[model samples]
Target: MTILLFGITKDIVGSPTLSVPTSSVTGKQVPKTVRELKQFLGDTYPELNKLSSLAVAVNHNYANDDDTINSYDEIALIPPVSGG
Candidate 1:
């Protein structure tokens, strides 16, 4: 699967795009869901788990916990922002 990081998330991943492994589901390489993706990211980058909160976007649209993702889809990580 391909994950597109934004803002601070880009820094965390150290790049704009990330290639993640996928498991076979009915002979197709399906990407993990939003919840599973979170666990994957946390396992890959432990520091992100310490953040207050984060939002996820799939194909430029916001995603919920129950949303299922595919390897061909685009995913992005959005961290909380603060400015003054």
Candidate 2:
């Protein structure tokens, strides 16, 4: 699955998108839900844990923790914003 990164999240991840593993050589699973995705990202990029807020979106709609994420689903990560 690919995660669209925005704002600080993009900078933290070092790209505007992130590719998450849905399957492994051994046929293991990874991040089947939004919550698991977040944890996976946090483990991969500890800086994500420092953010005050992070929103997950699935197919342009806000996603809850329990929301399932398929390998072909569209996901986005929106981080907190600050303005003058």
Candidate 3:
């Protein structure tokens, strides 16, 4: 799956886009859920785990914890924004 990183998420992955391995159940790179993606990100980049409450978007839409993702779908990691 290709995960798009925005805001601070870009710093976490060190890239705007990432090609992640697929899940066995879906036979695609899509992450099953927000939590699953978090775990995946943590595994791939342990540094991201230090951040609190990361957010996710699937197919240009914000997704919840129960949201299921598809391999061919577009996913984005949107970290909390901070500005003065």
Candidate 4:
């Protein structure tokens, strides 16, 4: 799965995008839900866990924790934004 990163998420991950391998290749449990995705990312990049708020978009739509995800889905990581 490819996840596009935005704002602090990009900074935290140190890249504009991240590539995650599928279970078939990694032989590890793949994240199947938004919540799991978050956990997977947070575990890989601990800085992500520090964000006060982070939103996940799947296929251009904001997704809830229970929302299902597949390797083929488009995922984006959006972080909190503040401006004066």
Candidate 5:
């Protein structure tokens, strides 16, 4: 599965996307829910935990912790926005 990145997230991740395995391979762990995904990402990319407010979107809609994530699902990380 690939997780799209936006704004600061992309900068921190050093790319526009994150590739997470759908099945455990080479000791990699797969996340099955928004919560798990966040935890996994936070562990992998500690910088993500520093965002003032981060949002998760699935299939173009905001997702809750309990929201399910499938191998083929679309996921993205959005950071806080500010306007002048």
Candidate 6:
């Protein structure tokens, strides 16, 4: 799965896109849900865990923690926005 990063998430990740293996190449379980995805990303990129608020979207729709994900799904990480 490829995760698109926006705002601070991009800076934190050092890239606009991240590729996640569908199969465990490192003996770690592949993320099958939004919640697990977050945990996986946080584990790989500790800086992401520091964000006060983070939102995830799957296939252009906002996804909840329990939302199921697949290798072919489009995932995006949206950080909290602040504007006047």
Of candidates 6 and 5, the better by lDDT? 6
Order of models, best TM-score first: 6, 5, 4, 2, 1, 3
lDDT of 6 by residue, 1-84 (tens): 899999999999899999999998879999999999999999999999999989999999999999999999999999999999
What candidate 2 gets wrong by more than 4 Å, as runs, is: 26-29
Native-to-model Cα distance after best TM-score fit, residue 23 in candidate 1, in Å: 3.4
Winner on lDDT (1 vs 5): 5
Local accuracy by lDDT, each model? 0.81, 0.90, 0.79, 0.92, 0.92, 0.95
Q: Pick the candidate with the highest TM-score.
A: 6
TM-score-superior candidate, 1 or 5: 5
Where does model 5 exceed 4 Å of error? none
How high is the lDDT of residue 80 in model 3? 78
Residues 10-72 of candidate 5 have per-residue lDDT tens digits of: 999999999998888847568889999999999999998988988999999999999999988
Q: Stretches of candidate 6 above 4 Å error?
A: none
With a 3 Å backbone cut-off (N, CA, C), the pairs that clash in candidate 1 are none
C-alpha positional error of residue 20 in candidate 2 after TM-score superposition, expressed in Å: 0.8
Better of 1 and 4 by TM-score: 4
Per lDDT, what order, best first?
A: 6, 4, 5, 2, 1, 3
lDDT per residue (tens digit) for residues 1-84 in model 3: 888888777876778899887856645344577778788778778978887768888888889888888788898888877789
Task: Return the TM-score for candidate 4, rounded to 2 decimals.
Answer: 0.92
lDDT for 45 (candidate 1):
90
Question: Backbone clash tally for model 4?
Answer: 0
In terms of lDDT, the poorest run of 10 residues in model 2 is 20-29
**What pairs collide in candidate 4?**
none
Question: How far out, in Å, is residue 80 in model 3?
Answer: 0.9
Better of 3 and 6 by lDDT: 6
Pairs that collide in candidate 5 are: none
